[model samples]
Target: MDKVKFGVLGCARVFERRMAPALKSAGNAVLHAVASRSLEKAQATAGKHGAAKAYGSYDALLADTDIEAVYIPLPNDQHAEWTVKALAAGKHVLCDKPLALSVSEAEWMAGAAAASGLRLMEGFMYRHHPQHKKVFEVLRSGAIGEPVHFRGIFTYPATADHAGIRWNPAQGGGAFLDVGVYPLNAARWLLESEPTEAKAIAITDPTSGVDSHTAALLAFPNNRTASLIGGFDQAFTSRYELVGREGSITVERAFQVGESGVRVLVRANNSDTEEAFFFEHTDQFQLEVEHFAACIRNSELSLEPGEDGVAQARAQALVLSSL
Candidate 1:
């Protein structure tokens, strides 16, 4: 239990470029194995990531007695099935977001994790970033007054190629499921409350039948509200603003703060000057890995636990159902 040995469920690109490096950097975690449908791909990824083992199928990795946990970066549609299977195999799970395509799927995954007595966390790595902690600090400090409204924008232009997995409806591809979850999760996180009612408008691609652009409004308790815009057909932009009666805070490059520093702008009502907070660069993914490992060794769940994923999925379902 000194260090958690993790087997990757898929050799996805994100694992190769981000999560694997984070795992290696985590002091209390080790990349033990990698699995892919193709043995060669698994071997290549495992070797590149310095993993000790590789398997052709996910089942093989799950069966490895040495692997105490699994990191799942599979397709959005496959999250629930693999998470349940991994939990059934007696392994803690850190699955990518959105945790599942629907509320029922998320509930099933959460139930399996609870039944198995294992830690199951949705990989919303941004929550581990120091910048967000600073944002919360500012909000709690009352510098921005009482946060009454929030808005987030996450969008990027789609490629000319229409065959990408994100463009495939069968794969759970859509603006809301893919990127909208970020803003939704963020609003809930910062607001510290779940949305009670939701509404959305989405522009579906004629060819893919997947949402290319979506705008959603979520109504929280205490008369608080949040607005989010996610799109696969707009200029690259990721930002959010929290507006209060007396002031407001704005965050640029919100979701992918990465190793680059982050800045939060605060403007108080009736004040001519704006206050700015800057945070040093941090590898949020590494922090996330260490946190998951720590929770595993300590026999606990994450601060952002499985129930948060369920709430997020429920809110998302409400939005999608409205459309």
Candidate 2:
């Protein structure tokens, strides 16, 4: 199969530090071009990342005939607009998560992709990691026996810059829309059910109008519920627990899978044991990029398709509305 040609939509920190390296590592993907509102930034990113072309405008990058796909790492609110434009430009898109602020916008993005016959995928890198797959496997093995309750938390200190994206409400910034989506989606994927109801509270930054902390509860059927805690004002913590009738499971550093090992503690029937699963040092970003490239090459939907993105967006909107 021919390598998929890729254009990057921005010179965001994520692009420079993460996606660009992942694209370089993908066996069947090429970083063909990049764009930024500033020509200098665009040129610098293209040069640093070996992109063949640079455009001062996103539309110019989308119009590149050689570019078969585009990765949009734009702000949350801009996801829908750029995704629609990229699809209309005849380029498949891999957009950053929380695809849009509302389900309506996500549906519009899905419609655009369908009408254009172009693939559109939400960028959920952790889902592609093998460690997460192991978690799914353990859950399916009945080790956790009929999950009853879940507790998930993802927290980190806020960025030092006041102008950072996470502090910009106009950019769709907030604890729930940002880190909170990870735990929310993880719960949805593990439970294999959509949340029937959501309640959330937020501690907002008065100056920025963005949330600094958020706590939410998602109610599922079978009298089950998931507690989600996320914020930008706390020390680093990424952990999850699944409590079942027979036993329980706890995962540390649940969101990031690394080379060292993944710790999974399983307790059942009054017995407790732990095991560490190790895998090759694979970059989640590379795995995600490879998945998108394969989908674009085959004209198929990616693992986390637009529908999943829309579902997550709906859940996010529900939480936001409650707050």
| Candidate 2 per-residue C-alpha lDDT over 210-319 given as tens digits, one digit per residue, 9 for 90 to 100 | 88889998898888999998888899888888888888877776876555756666676545665555556679899889988887777545455335877887788777
Where does candidate 1 stray beyond 4 Å?
300-302
Candidate 2 global TM-score: 0.94
Best by lDDT: 1
Model 2 residue 231 CA deviation (Å) reads 0.9
TM-score of each: 0.96, 0.94
Error of 1 at 321 (Å): 1.0
lDDT of 1 by residue, 51-127 (tens): 99999999999999999999999989899999999999999999998898988999999999889989889998888
Query: What lDDT score is found at residue 316 in candidate 2?
Result: 80
Clashing residue pairs found in predicted model 2? none
Best by TM-score: 1
TM-score of 1: 0.96
